[model samples]
Target: MLVFWNARLVFLSVPKTGTTAIEGAFAPHADMVISHPPELKHAPLYRYNRFFRPMFERACKVEDMETLAVMREPISWLASWYRYRQRNFMQGHPNSTHNVSFDEFVNAYMRGDKPAFANVGSQAKFLEPRPNGTRINHLFRYEDQSRLLNFLQDRIKQKVSLERRNASPRTQLDLSPETLKKYQRKFSAEFDLYNSIS
Candidate 1:
């Protein structure tokens, strides 16, 4: 996550949404950057509200720091996670997807108790609004990088250029229609949230 203190803006890093690339581009201007420890790097809206919000509110006496986050098309986001776990380094890891078919991967993800390989967290849950009405002030679709960059540039007053980083391996992830239907049904919240982000 990146916070531009003067701009009163926070960029919540949603995993697998090109956040590494975005951070590479925007970190220079951010007053505070939580880039270490994956949990903190990808802290969701609720975590931010629970932790960072209090820090800013009490220590900095800033109560109006607005947030921004990017959400990817749900299926594509899952595919990225699938491919990521298939990397060469994950060869013997329990969470590796090296031998799993994409259809099997999706089915595993739909399980009430997901298998290690398909346990990636949902973008919808990550960006859900807190009960106190704390929410991302600017949310953009990951597929639309230009709009996101433009907004950040205008707000942070910085020239931006995104370098390719943290890319997943190239893999064919053609889901069968039956599996696709089931996935769409089971994980509709993810699709709903992404579609709602216009």
Candidate 2:
């Protein structure tokens, strides 16, 4: 997560949504950057409200900072996770996807008891609105980099450049129609959230 205190903006890093690239690009300009401890790095809305929000509200006396996030197409997001875990360094890890087909991986993901390899967190849950109505002020589609960059440049008043970082391995991934249907049904919240992003 990158906090632009002067801009009164907080960019929440949703995993696998090209947030790493954005963080790298904006790190120099950000007032505070949380890049360690994956849990805090990808602190979701509830976490933000529980932790960061109170800190700012009490200490900084800041109550209206806007938040930003990005969501990728659901299937592609899952595919990225599958490929990401297949990297060489993760070969023997319990969460490695080295031996699983994309189909099997996704099937496991839908299980109530997901295997470590398929336990990636949901994008929808990551950005869910808080009960207090704290929500993202600017939500961008990961595929729509132009708009995201445009918004950042306008807000920060500086030209921004991005270089791809932490890309998942290349692979041809296709979900069978039946599996896709099941996934959509089971994870309707994810699809609904992405669709609502515009």
Candidate 3:
């Protein structure tokens, strides 16, 4: 996450949404950057509200920071996770996708108790609004990099260039039509949320 205190903006890093690249591009200009420790780097809306929000509001006396986050298309996002876990080093890890097919991984994800390989968190859940009404002020689609870049440049008044970073390994990923339909139906929020965003 990158916080631009002067601009009253915080960029929430959603996993697999090109946030690493975004963080790298803006870290130099950010007032505070939480780039270490994956948990903090990808703190969801609830975590932010629970921890960081209080810090800003009570300690810093800043309560009006706007939050920004990116959401990738659901299937593509899952594909990234599948490929990421397939890395050689992940071979014997509980979350490894070493010998799993995309369909099997996704199917496991739909279960009440997901296997580690298919337990990647949901994008919609990550950005869900809190009971107190805290929510993302600006949400961009991962596929729409130009819009995000323009918004950042306009807000920060600087040139920003992002390099491709932490890309998952290549894989031939295709889910069966039935499985795709099931996934869309079961986790409609992810699709609905992405579609709602311009």
Ranked by lDDT, the better of candidates 1 and 3 is 3
What is the C-alpha lDDT profile of model 3 across 28-117, one tens digit per residue? 999999988989999999999999999999999998999999999999999999999999989899999988999999999999899878
For each of the candidates, the C-alpha root-mean-square deviation to the true structure, in angstroms, is: 0.7, 0.8, 0.8
Cα error, candidate 3, residue 53 (Å): 1.1
Q: Show where candidate 2 strays beyond 4 Å.
A: none
TM-score of 3: 0.98
Question: What stretches of model 3 exceed 4 Å from their correct place?
Answer: none
lDDT to native, each model: 0.93, 0.92, 0.94
Please tell me which model should have the higher lDDT, number 2 or number 3: 3
Clashes of 3: 0
By lDDT, highest first, what's the ranking? 3, 1, 2
Give TM-scores for every candidate, taking all chains together and pairing residue i with residue i.
Answer: 0.98, 0.98, 0.98
Model 2 scores worst on lDDT over the 10 consecutive residues at 167-176
Over 80-105, each residue of candidate 2 has an lDDT whose tens digit, in order, gives 99999989999899999987899999
